[model samples]
Target: MTQPSREAIQTLVTQCLQEILNQRGTELSAPLTADTPMFGTGGLLDSIGIVTMIVDVEQTIAAEFNATVSLADDRAMSQRNSPYRSISALTDYILGQLSEGA
Candidate 1:
């Protein structure tokens, strides 16, 4: 199976962020970009917000990509650099998971 392109994954991730922002009735201080921080103290999301985003991302992947993945599993937690750290990292991680699932 072919891996999804980075642009495709980034688009999906951005859509997820927008959906979450809309639900929370909040706006980002800056626009979402590859360098945008996602989790942790200075990031756009709090703990609950991160959880919500992860769930939304996972569901989006399943619905859109026809693949089931667990984005917050033990493997993700064990990573030296978290997959959840930035938009770029998360997009790469999702692509990796999709490749693995394929």
Candidate 2:
């Protein structure tokens, strides 16, 4: 597959987050965006929700990009700034992973 742009990855990440919120019957005061907090203070997701999102994202990426990625692996945990912190961070991390695999 051709390398995806940052916007493409961000869009995919946003869609996955929105889907997870919808599944949980959540209605946000604001739309989910690149700056939306994901797993920390004032975040949308709890531990379970984060886990669900991770699985959903990984599965969707595999289907969409035909590449398998482990989003919550050791490397992710060891990062100085967590990729799960926000949509933008997650998108960047995924983009890097895809690039490395390519």
TM-score of each: 0.90, 0.94
Model 2: clashing residue pairs?
none
Worst ten-residue run, lDDT, model 1? 37-46
RMSD of 1: 1.4
> What lDDT does model 1 reach?
0.86
Worst lDDT run of 10 residues, candidate 2, spans 1-10
Report how far residue 38 has shifted in candidate 1, in Å: 0.6
Error of 1 at 58 (Å): 0.8
Q: What are the per-residue Cα lDDT tens digits for candidate 2 across 34-100?
A: 9999987889999999999999999998898888888999999888889999999999999989989
- lDDT of all the models against the reference? 0.86, 0.90
lDDT of 2: 0.90
Off by over 4 Å in 2: none
Give candidate 1's error at residue 53 in angstroms: 0.7
By how many angstroms RMSD does model 2 differ from the true structure?
A: 1.0
